[model samples]
Target: MDFAFTPEEERFREELHQLLLTNLPGDWAKRGLAEPIDSEERHALADLLSKQLAERKWLTMAWPEKFGGLDASYLMQYLFNEEMAYLDAPGGGGVGVTSVGPAIMMYGSEEQQRIYLPRIANADDRWAALYSEPGAGSDLASIQTRAVRDGDEYVINGLKTWVAGADRATMGWLAARTDPNGPKHRGLSTFAVPMDDPGVEIRPIENLAGERQLSEVLLHDVRVPIENRVGPENRGWYHVASTLDFERSGVASYARGKRHIEQLVDLVKENSTLSDQRQAVRYELADRWIELQVGFNVAQRIPWLQTQGISPNHEASVSKVYGSEMTQRIAGTGVRLLGMAGLLQRGTDGAPAGGAFARHYLTSAGSTIAAGTSEIQRNIIAQRGLGLPR
Candidate 1:
């Protein structure tokens, strides 16, 4: 496969870059740079960015025209995401925009598509993935969230933990056990639940950064209309798997990390007094570069695999595992390089890089666990990619 973007794709990249530069809210980026707390300010900024994305039809650029997407090439989508991440602009929560959008396009009814896709693109309907529970983390089939059908709606009851963006999400893509006696993977179903529904309760959970990055959601007989269900009943387990495949597929980014790596390199170069530290940083950063490149190559081949009607599951697992771990290492090195100053909170006066390294370190540590744990990804690589016995 060609590693080069065509001229048209290059033009598309420039167009999007220009759009971000021109229309992106200046105050939003300013507040992000100032507070950088991932708080209400960030949400306000995301709301502004989401509107801009919706206006440009960029929020659904990867979707088909029928669903309000631009039907662009994979390269264009990659460029868009890289640009957004590099600018520190909100990508509008990964699950709603990236993962569930594609799943809905594939499995949801016309009404479901029409109702949800547009809101995802334009409205501040942040979404959370309700797959894992306290009893079921890496092994998702062990999920115990139950949904029992009654008169016209299903009553959902259970707890979902470590659900990202749940504190602010307007809706959630929830997985629940619908058939308790069926096979482990065959008893589940997926539903789109309004986060503000009466029986739903959200309690924010702080991360290593001392920020509320995730949440614990409790459903106490939450009633969801049948129309909210996606795909066939008792088949939610498959839907969740499909959605995760989409999530893990987009992990690699040569360009998004490039600037940070360069910044680290330049810092090391300028501080020649710390020769040993600089050398270590250089060596580790070089390894990260290679890892990013490998991820990029694998990511590029994925489009072709999809075109040929393949799942790209194994390749995605490899990328997700390698990329997330490498990111943690890279950010960890950055924090070490900054020494005590790195541990300073974001608002500290004279903090190095305005405490960005510390933030990255904390955030990167969570990435490995979120999409899938490193050990779980390796299990997938061993079983699916290498054809080993489970």
Candidate 2:
């Protein structure tokens, strides 16, 4: 029941913290985690920081040594993610490192592994998860995207929406239907698709925060070699499910929430006007801090379960649902504390915290929707965790 990290893990955390402080731009905090990198300079800075992290082999530390990683423990990877999230640092490798790379390791062929794993570990290419389609998001089994076999290649045609980082990705970890006659879940297959291939189009989608970080990708008659298929044909549903489990651990979300709560506390303490309502704000902040800790503890269990050779399913759902909903609650509390000023957009003259909380308030609305909806997570908890009759 010991909750403390080992000495080596603590040292690694401190080293990563110092590395981020030294490498990040001075004004990086001002931009805030809630705001997307909208300018060329910010994009350049993100690219630079990503390269620096890759050089340190911290981007994919948990992967095997043969795949250009340090073979670090899962707990170490969790610590790394927590540190990066707290700082809002770039170069954690996004889906490329977290979901796609692990999925490839578990399901990809030897040739596919050799071709893609190193590039992912080295940050040579950004990858997007092309799974959710216009017609199929929460009900992923209903996806209509098709990848029909055509001799030595597969001809793909579909529209994938809500793809984060699609505009910047060099590759796509795609899921498409390969067998229409089978059950919805059994008919799907996964593929490693080149983003630059013919008939692939990426269009940005602006969210409530006015950020185009999410995009829609259109594929029409796009041809990839049969070698690009990752898992067994007509069995991609299970592979996609596993990939999502990697994403749902929610450690980073809790860490990010912790940072935001700390900033909110500082804002309340420093502002004379906010100090007038100190008692109420103090109670709210305390509640938020406590909830964040609870969520973080829930998230930490996932890595521990992995270390024990247990695949966390319902546990991951519990973490994701709590963390994402906690985010929304924290954002709501921040806006309420800021009063009318919370409505002010970023870059405004009198906006508080550079309008970070306002931006977060808008973006947090989607926290419950992305990855899987809150309702979906609840179902997982009920059916898988509680053993409820469905």
Candidate 3:
């Protein structure tokens, strides 16, 4: 099979690169892509970037032309992500455009689609995942966040922890327990809940990098309209399973990780002394590149699966587990190569890569933890893909 993009795809890539050049402020995109933004800064960047992307109709490129997207091919989507990550530009927020948007497109009602899709497209709204309770990390089915049906509303009650990007989010793609009597996995339901609802409380959790990139969200009788629900009432496991599948399929996993691999190689070349040290680092970097290439190959399978009307569940799980762990290893190796300088914090006088390596080293530990852990991915691979006994 041909791995290279066709001439038409090449033209699309050129056009997308030009769009990034013309619309994105170079310094802003560079910084935004590289570092996690503070609440105010995130809002500012979202406003500016959303407006710019909306003006060019670039924000919704993966959607159909009727929904304001350019009806771009999956290859174009992959190309756009590669270009964005290569430049260290935050091309699209993962939770919004990648995971939730597709879920909405698939499960949402026509009216719901019209309302939310444009908001997401314009960057007028931002989303955070409301999964992973304090008690339910790897075992997502054990989530106790309750959503009791009350007349036309569902009263959501429980706490969700380790929720990334919830501080600035206007909305949440929330999962809550709706059927206590059903099987653990069967009782769950997913909904789009407003983050600012009076019953919802958000408390920030600081990370090793001194950034409030995570949140503990308490939901107390937070009433969600039943219409806001996605898919069937109690089939949320399927929704989440499908969403995780989408996350696994995106090019961002490989694209973003590969950019860091390149950065690590550059750091090693610039800083390493002995030929042995350089050679060792070069070999490790090459190995990381190969792992990332595997992820890229998996990403290429998504569109074909979509066309074939398959969920891509097993493939996505494989990519997410392998790709995320690979990123952590590569980032940690970079810090080790830096020796004493690796621990330098950002805003400190004369830190390497503005202490970017330090940030990555600290945060990479959680990369495997977030979304789904390595162990969880392995479970998916064993049970779902290999048909091993659970």
Candidate 4:
């Protein structure tokens, strides 16, 4: 089967690259994509970049026009993500643009669609996800956070861990148990809560990467309006499942890996000297490039399948498993190839690639863990894809 993008898609890619070339802020490539933007200066710059994308309606390219999107082809959606990944664009903000917004569009009420889609579409909103609790992560159906109804509001109380971007988010989507007596998978419910509400507290978690990008979110009797509920009550499992499918299928990992592989190829070509080890280095880089191309082609196929009204669940599992693991491997190779210099932090005088590889190596560990773990992906491939029994 042919794997290359159509002429129109190629033109679209060139157009987006030009747009980023002209509009992206100075230092955006060297700093914005490389460093964590939790600081005010970085965040402001990222926001400016986000607005640039918003103005172009690239933030919601695949959504319907009623939601401020361009009603573009799904291919545009695929292309948009690929460009963002290749350019290291910071325009896509929070879970709103990536995971929650699409979920809302697919499963939310008309009022919710009216209220949130425009803000998200325009980069006027940021969202965090409060899905994993202290002990309830991979087995999300067992989440114990409780939410009870009281006069048009659901009072919430629980702890959520690994909540990425909660400190910077205006709103958050959380899963809580609404029926204590119901089955593990049946009692769950999802809602959107204002992050700045009186009862919600976010304590930042700093990792080895020296970034406070993730956090532990505590909800102490947080009150969510009945209207904030996503999908039907006690049916969040299905909504969350659909959203996860979207996350796996969005092609972010493939785009990211493809970009990093290209960077590595350039690095190999430009940096290596005529030494005895040059042949091996070239072989390594060539191997990565070949794998990435195969992955890119595989990535491109899913959106096309979706357009043809195919489910692509098993295919998404394969893509996620491959893309996320490949990302980690690519970054690991970057560090290995560059040796000590690659591990150097930014601002170090001799840090290789401006310490981009170091940050990526540290950050790559989480990519395999988040959005469901590699272990889970393997499980999915075995059971769902291969039709194996538990």
Best by lDDT: 2
Q: Which stretches of candidate 3 lie over 4 Å from their true place?
A: 22-34, 39-43, 91-93, 272-276
- Report, for all candidates in order, the number of backbone clashes: 1, 0, 0, 0
Stretches of candidate 2 off by over 4 Å are none
Which candidate has the top score in TM-score? Answer: 2
**Candidate 4 displacement at residue 210 in angstroms:** 0.8
lDDT of 1 by residue, 213-271 (tens): 68899999899999999989998877778767655655344444555566667666777
TM-score of each: 0.92, 0.97, 0.90, 0.94
Which residue pairs clash within candidate 1?
189-236
- lDDT per residue as tens, model 3, 1-390: 346888988887787677667755656433443465454655565566567767666776778877668887765676766776665554365588877788888788898888888888877788999998989998889989999999998999999999978888899999899999999999999999999999989999988877897899999889989899988888887778776765666476677777677666666667646356767766777888888888888777776576567878777777777778877887777677777787786767756666777777887788787877888888888998999998
lDDT over C-alpha atoms for residue 81 of model 4: 81
Ranking by lDDT: 2, 4, 3, 1
**Between candidates 2 and 4, the lDDT winner:** 2
Model 2 TM-score? 0.97
lDDT of 4 by residue, 1-390 (tens): 456678988998898888777867666665544666466766776688789878888878887888888888777788888887777776566578767888898889999999998999999888998899878887799799999999999999999999888888999998999999989899998899999899998899987689898899999989888999988999988788776765666367767666666666666666745255787777877777787887887777878887887767878878888888888888888888877777988778877657778888998888877777788888988998899998
Candidate 1 is scored at a TM of 0.92
Question: Weakest 10 consecutive residues, lDDT, candidate 2?
Answer: 33-42
How many residue pairs of model 2 clash at the backbone? 0
Structural RMSD, model 3 = 2.6
